[model samples]
Target chain A: MSDGVEVSVVLPAYNEADTIEETVRVTLETLDSFLPAGAYEVIVAEDGCADRTPEIAARLAREDDRVRHVHSDERLGRGGALEYAFERARGETLVYFDTDLATDMRHLEELVESIRTDGYDVATGSRWLPENRADRPAKRGIPSFGYNTLVRTVLRSDLRDHQCGFKAFDRTALESLLPAVGDEHWFWDTEVLVKAQRRGYRVKEFPVDWTPKGDSKVDIVRDVFGMGSQILRTFWELSVSPRITRRVSLGAGTALVVVALLLMTQYLDPQAVLTRMAGADPGIVLASALVYAVSWPLRGARYRDILSSMGYREHWGFLTGAVFISQTGNLVFPARAGDAVRAYVVKARRSIPYPTGFASLAVERVFDLLTITLLAGVVMVALAATGSADQLLVALTDGAVGATRPPAGGPLSPSPPASASPPSLQ
Target chain B: MTAIVASARTDRNFVRRTVGALSDDSYADYVAGVVERFVGDVQTVAADASAFGRVGGASLLIWSLDVVTAIVVFAAFGVDVTLAVVAVGFFAVSVGNLAKVLPLTPGGVGLYEGAFTLIMAALTPVGVATALSIAIVDHAVKNVVTIAGGVASMAWLNVSLTKAVEESQSAGDVEVEADD
Candidate 1:
């Protein structure tokens, strides 16, 4: 595709003295099988090697014109070295790999062919694909699986392996994508691929046999954390910081309130309810309020007992206050959001784990339901035995029928004059 | 050494039995496995024997107060109700209380009122307006007390309602993590 060279294979090496010569020899042989002598060249980026790697690479460069070495006096990371080599590449297509040749050499041809024949702007090798074969211990494999899953979730990308280290790129495509890829370290591969996808470029993935070779230079924990942060940064830049998120949240909240109001108006009669409330007896209201107030302390005592049984011995007053706060939250919010508040109170004030608090809350609910159901069951059986069940059903159905009747005053006539009510049933 | 070999043999037999059962099409084995796990978790949080009376007594007291509140409100409305009628109304109130736990609305607002009023009209010869009036009064008294109590508790504990709600939402997230 270019005047003299069809492909440039860049091997980014750093302190790879042990495997540099063999890697170079195998690469040269691999390229020679498919290309003419001058059609392809191998560039070994000796990235500030403090060992015999630079000397070996330099010697190889001198022995054959096809083998060239680019040296940096200071440490350029894997991405930095690739960036340096890519700038000097003369081929129409560029390929890069780790110095250890972790990927099978057979797939190298397939990667390059994908760009030349399949018309993909970039071809990446995947070790995690279902058809791919990778030989690595669980110690390494587990983290790799986890990291890739995080990448897929956070960046919302479909690439199977972003850190495979064996990728081929169309020269023009790489140059166009390079301006947006700012990472100089391990995250460069992910940034470039994500950006490429966002820009609607076609990327092809090929299954490859990958075997771990030599000791790895990667600090797994550090790199995982660094990549996680980078993923978040990219997500913020590409998605969240925009005005669309705020607009959608605002719109959804408004819709919920409007729908809730509409439902409330449909189901409830505001005028009748207000009228009844106005006529309510103050003395009876005060009595009901006192009974309700008494129940709060009882509820608190129950909560304290449950927590104490669970080995979280909190003061009775504190537990009662916690229940009050949680109940308040329930009253204020919908869907029992206050239950979570209760759990938080337990965790914050008593140092109990949230789950344990939640479990206790669940137990309390079970008891409450059990008690209320038992009472209701006993009363229903009593009513049935006394033959009052039939009368009650008749009255209930009559009242329901009366409610739907057309006339303003039917069997369920508007409240009969309070002073002229029928004689007491007693 | 003999005990160790015996225990290992027992464990192997158990695994073999489990595999054989699961290989069959019958779902009884799966049901048993689920039941066993559930029972094991329940066992971990079982309350101490000593606290049983306190919890039981508190539950009874709370339910009794709910019934009393219903009775008092009905009387206050000048409704001619007998003792038996009062008992029947309490049953209806209990059912309504249980329905409130469903969270159909804030504090089961419309749901509780509908259920309670329907039961009142059915059990007594009261007009729909009277039943509706009774239902509203009953709920208002409870809710007014609840709001007042909540505000007072917030002040007593020095916790803001907003912070409580936020903490509650986050606690739900923590529960999900714990479950995982």
Candidate 2:
């Protein structure tokens, strides 16, 4: 073993005949600046080449025992090659870099510092320091640029760039992350970051410096489309996977409370509401039933559309049944317990991440809330316009006597407890 | 030979069905084809009858934006407006949702209005009084509104009221097809 190595720098190489030897020489010579005082090993994953790439890498390995070479008969792309090399490597802190050397050894030092000392679970490099993406070529860069923007807008992730590949992680972090890596292709980077975020592990994105390497084997256009689809899917998931749906479920349960109140309104002469239900017109009862019955399916359809957009062609009927069963559990129990049931059903049925499937439920609710608010807004406007504004104003001030408040009390608590009944109403 | 026969049959019919499903003009026909399959099925019939069970389950499980709607509508009355009339009016609709949910009681029978009425019953009297007057008139308006809203939604969707009703009816049933 070359100079008794301690760090393993696993580099996955495709048909980079022009840059192969230099990449190997540079990595071996610059090893002093990259690794600690102990021994460092370089692993080149040789796949995807008709050239003498494997031959050159082997000669380097033969000359310097510190350099280890792996020749894969079949090309596994960047992800598979790394998977193979990392599987074989003995490095305590496993790191993989692009052969282009676009990002220098100095950034590796920073990554090493973050991993070794900075109390972070994963230290990744980001190129998202600037919006230089627009300067990039269209077919390759446009989709990726548009994709990251979509994820940030929809998922609202602070990660500037999830698509960049020049990342280094603690050996332990990589080991832990690798098992859950769903995609064996370019989407590997996006998946790893998402899993880290969802699992509540600390993932730090540090901007790195780089020059784009030669005619990149990276079909950037194709991968960006795929990664975008993946990120959106995960965005739908983790956003709703947590207790939000259940909270929403709990919130939906309150619709019953609302219904009860509406029915009560008919009876506020309580005597009359009952007589109306019993007598000539059970009209209110029928209307209320229609609302309750319609809520679930409308919700199911929303999720169906969302899933289809994300590349899962789910049957609405199957989704509706799953939603129905899960919600029933949520309603029977309190505080959104129905979410676990929902997660289980989807995971069991479709084998999707519980959180991603759960997010669809939450997204659906966002729609529902928007719909209800818009309708409520119209109704409120109508009521206010009719000079019933004073009535609407008082109800907002009056807290539920015993009705439990929203756990987050989000929009409901926007106005601090002033109790100032719209002074104009006065 | 058997595999070859199976392959041939799939190639013969599958291609036609795929084209039929994908053609933009055929989507309506494709969806109609599915609906027709369930028309005579017992489980589908049973499902329509027990649609409440599915809808009931959904409210507790779904946790959608509607929750915010109920809260916002209810909150509007007291939170800022502080008018007894508005508070009661918003509440009537929320409870109207709740009472409707009651019948689907594991997903059973009750109304949002009924459930809401109960919540209001527990509230202070003045608000309850306002809530009552609003409930009486709101439904007449709400029905017009619900119908208008439904019609508008159907129109926006480029579907018929018949389809909307079918969707509404089918929406209540949990399993139109078996889960894979």
Candidate 3:
């Protein structure tokens, strides 16, 4: 038992016979120069190595007591091997790095110093920091930038490089974070850092020189999907789980209903409304219904003309039908699901592109608003000429709907305002 | 117009930056491809300016018909419809229709009625009760006709309401796939 070791450097290796030896030798040399000989140990966690990596690592362990090799017959993946080694490490501070040593070893001193002196629980190497230098092909750089950005945005974490492969942690911090990290693969780094940040642990990032060593074993497409799913899962667990969101929604909904009911009670009188509705003239109702019927065809015609202009020629009936169905959908669904339905209907019927259909729908709405505003302008002009604008403004500001009583003897006012004689439909 | 143009430009820049940061070159290329197709459609639409003019003209006519409906309702209640009433009714109808865009209630049912009645009471010599009665009658007329016309169109187009609703709801996702 290396109970006296203050720093334990863990190198998780898999099929890395080519670079593992050099990485271990350089890491040992770096540790020897800065850390005392008996205070630190290098651990090689070789898991499911099909190459000569396990044998070479075992030989090194036999040659030097400072070097220790732990081998697993079955593949536990990089994260699993690290976890296995981490459990057995006896040092106060544990460091882990990829066998390829893609990150510069010179940053090791600062990374260790950050935890040892600066009071940070974890210190990580960041290739994305402004002072950091990363030499890699554009094909790799672009995806790396995008993936890191997605991790930062979705997890809302301050750490820039979650998968930098070079990191050091206080043993206590790792113990607290490891149990919550569910991923056993490449996402392990992200999960650990995210959980650590959420749990209020201080994380420091140091700029490092990173160079591509050899062909990467990662499947970019599969790993991107995997990492993205993990980010979403972590986000859900930390911020938007049903436990929190459902309670918030219920509270907000209850508050809104209470407010609406208060407003309704202040503004509406049920008995007055019932009496007025009972006295409504059927002849005028029929006429208004006819006018509404006329508006539908006009609306349909306008939509047909708009679609035709957009080079999506559909029959007038079809365009009208689409509008009618969408309106009905709006009546039934929330969040304007009707608009989505309308775009779908156009695509399914006319073979128009969805964006084009969406653009047309937007334009249609703009036109409708424009027309309404134009007509309102005409009314405003008339009102200004008659000097009735003040009356309207007064009513708007008064807040009391019943304060501005109509002229008692005016022909427009019903005989008994709220209890007027019922008007006959005939 | 200036405000609209500036807002659109700002929105486009925001979208571009957000997408660029969140995706690779291939995803950007995919987005650019969709934008190009949409631009082509817009250009085609712009080339035929007369069609939009015709549609605008028809919209004006439809709006005028709504004003006439309001006048008829006022006269039926023995309100002695005047020019001022006609103008106020037109303004109320326009405001009410615009308010329907807000999903305060399904089809802006309560909102439109409340807005139209309040506007009538404020602008015309009509009492609140009378204005509310007019508003209710107007909405009932329009909604009943809309439901009837929608059902008829559904039959004519061989679309079931249930199926149409479902399809419309998922249409955006389908469009996303098609865009891809």
Which one wins on TM-score?
A: 3
Interface RMSD of 2: 17.1
lDDT of 3 by residue, A36-114 (tens): 7788888999988889999999999998888899888976756778999989877888899877888888888887778
Off by over 4 Å in 3: A1-268, A381-386, A402-407, A410-426, B1-47, B174-180
Candidate 2 A-chain TM-score? 0.52
Clashes of each: 1, 95, 1
C-alpha local distance difference test of each model: 0.72, 0.53, 0.73
- DockQ for candidate 1, please give it: 0.22
Task: Report residue A307 deviation for candidate 3 (angstroms).
Answer: 1.0
How does residue B107 of candidate 1 score in lDDT? Answer: 67
Pick out the ten consecutive residues of candidate 2 chain A with the lowest summed lDDT.
Answer: A417-426
lDDT of 2 at A293: 47
Tens-digit lDDT track of model 1 for A1-426: 236987899998888899999999999999888777898889999877889999999999999888889999976666777999999988888999887888889888898888876788988999899987786788788878888888888888889898889998999999999987866667788888888888889998888999898755445333544566678878877777674453464455446546754654554555644665556556766877787778888888888888777778777778878887787777667667787888877777668987778877766765677678878888888888887688678766654624522214333223343445532321
Q: For all the predictions, what are the DockQ values?
A: 0.22, 0.06, 0.26
Q: Distance from true position, residue A149, model 1, in Å?
A: 34
Off by over 4 Å in 1: A1-275, A388-426, B1-47, B177-180
**RMSDs, each prediction?**
15.3, 17.1, 13.9
In model 3, residue pairs whose N, Cα or C atoms come closer than 3 Å (at least 3 residues apart or on different chains), thus clashing, are A341-B168
